[model samples]
Target: MSNPHKKEQHTGKDLPRWGMVIDLDRCVGCHTCEIACKMENDVPLGIWRSWVKEIEKGKYPNVVRSFRPTLCNHCENPACVKVCPVGAAWQREDGIVMVDPHLCVGCRYCMSACPYEVRYVHPQKGMIDKCDFCHTRVDAGLKPSCVEACPASARIFGNLNDPKSDVSKLVSTKSVTTLKPEMGTDPRVYYIGLDMATMEIKREAKLVWEK
Candidate 1:
């Protein structure tokens, strides 16, 4: 008997341009995505290319909880791109941020320039490292490890430019937000369930620590 629910293989132009939508409402702060990302990318200990940042607000009894999974913003106007002296980092035509590992001189300029603090200097690779948006699996027509491993289905990946795409539809229907909007990075990643209170907590923390 033929299976009616078999996963279809992507081919040619049917392959979607990549984007990620994180539903904060569904996220349990489990850190599964973080572990999945590290394992799939072989990211070493003490140097995470992706991570989860948790925010707790209010006085002890009235506290509210929020979890923000942070990764390279893959900004439309990536500061890392302009700061790289060796031109190792660049934004792709489809809006993905990437680095030429061979071209990187480990100067750490990109690390300093990124407002999101997602870039890291790899000790063994001897190069600047950050999320490549799971380009390997993406190119092979598979979802990113984090997206696949998410137990809550809190993450969605697709093309922002495609009107019919799930990400585009969700953004249109939901109140989505990005981190560090003041930096004018125009981050491609979007988050749902983020509120003013959550934003305020993050803002205050950054101002205190970044100083």
Candidate 2:
């Protein structure tokens, strides 16, 4: 594994704006992605870098289970980056939001400002942490663990700036929507076939952080 702290080289050509698109229609609610993320990032037991939110709909006899995968949105106008007083939270040239654990003072300012509630204080290090799309692996030219481990192939990761990328094509051609578009964050994560009722739901797992 490459050292995650090393600064990656950047050339002046068109930088890829990395993003994701989840095809809810293809998701199986298997939680494979949830497990894969934890294994890859070594996320703490109580905290999650990513998780699947499941909800049952319809009457007893006729019911359906819907899943919403929760992770850092990596927003274009990230509130975490804007609110970080120490500049610990920053966005990469490719739109991935990252945190500098060394610079973080455990102020929790970013945690409060973030709408996604994905950020958490590392139990041991006392630094803020969250999903960075597995930057080290991505920098190594590998797909995110969740993307590769998804059995249904529901999670699509790619360069949104490139029209040829799958994520870009789906986002432009499919009926996709992002979480909290009204917040004006311009979240890079988009979802297809996301239930309208669950659009505003913050999910029970996300609330555990406050306790």
Candidate 3:
């Protein structure tokens, strides 16, 4: 039932490159995003799809806590995809990194390869799972649950390929940084006003491989 008059659809480079931005200035370390993600994704009780990591600095009276929200970076050059022997770890044309549960054998090879240590084994499903930026909702013309649930509107999600997109504008204009940029993954997730102390504290023991 081919429609001879059907219009051509955009593909490859023309499609939207999904990305996210976390504005630390607006974030309150509330863990609301994590709870929203867990509820929306049906994640196992012992694990989380995302979380807000808090780190304290300075003396008691002058102490300050910084927050780093963690999730799948969905990199342009993903280490997981490279190390997945079965090709279970794959990326969309729009740059969303996803694991095909049907193809994944729970080998945990991708887990060892991921520098960010975001992927986790589903306790019941025995498959590696991580955030997919809520692609289903994106295709339905909606935002990711975590983004929509941010009480302070700290998270911004949009097509990075579009110059007019919020993510694109912010990344281009702000002093943003990504985790482990030196690793060459070229992560799409960006953070403004990120505290290196928090990043260091969070990655202290989770990294499986030496830099």
Candidate 4:
């Protein structure tokens, strides 16, 4: 009998889940990742699908700077999905949140519901737009454009369910925090090396705008 075991061999599934861990310390406040995401996604001008948010903290004499790259949190309990009058905005079982432009009525409800302000109504298309976490690229076994383009390797992507995965490992070893823990959205994106003062400023800004 020729190699029966070889013929019966099974191929394990490719990683299905996606999560990102951003190292705030390694980020140089360079907007390279943001630009890369825009270019890759072909997002329109005056409407960024991803962006870098800067926070300056301290008194007049001494100040500290911090940078945060913000995008759709892809929350486990996404408020956008709940508020959509139509079934346009939905989160996939694999954790990617997306919007169906064809079905969207452009009511902007989803935009208002997103606390992170990542969602925007497309100027021309009139449909709400936000980061899809590069679902197309993820399906192809490639990293998201931002993750691939980061020179500092500050953004790490992997399956959170897998304990051996890089994302899981980083979360285990580092001090990680999410954007709005109070909201209880259960955001999957984790940030490391974040300054508490900088986070407070961001929270204050979000509260004022209600975005």
Q: Against the true structure, what is each candidate's TM-score?
A: 0.84, 0.89, 0.89, 0.85
Worst 10 residues of 2 by lDDT: 3-12
Which rank order by TM-score, best down to worst?
3, 2, 4, 1
- What is the lDDT, from 0 to 100, of the residue 209 in candidate 3? 79
lDDT agreement of model 4 with the native: 0.82
Candidate 2 wrong stretches, greater than 4 Å: 1-13, 200-211
lDDT of 4 by residue, 1-211 (tens): 3221112211234535568999988998888888999899999887788788788877887978888888788887788887888778877767778898767889998888888888988888888889998999988988999999999998998888788999999999998999887887889899998766655533344344545
- Candidate number that wins on lDDT, 2 or 4: 2
Which of 2 and 3 is ahead in lDDT? 3
**What is the C-alpha lDDT profile of model 2 across 1-211, one tens digit per residue?**
5434344543434898889999999999999998999999998898899988888889989989888998999998889887888778888888899998767899999999998899999999999999999999999999999999999999999988889989999999998999888888999999999986554455555543544
lDDT of 2: 0.88
Candidate 4 clash pair list:
none
Local error of candidate 1 at residue 24 (angstroms): 0.3
**Backbone clashes under 3 angstroms, per model:** 0, 0, 0, 0
Instruction: Give per-residue CA lDDT, model 3, range 152-190, as digits (tens).
Output: 999999998899999999999999999999999999999
Clashing pairs in 2: none
| TM-score of model 1 vs. true structure | 0.84
Between candidates 1 and 4, which one is better according to TM-score?
4
Query: Rank by lDDT, descending?
Result: 3, 2, 4, 1
lDDT of 1 at 196: 51
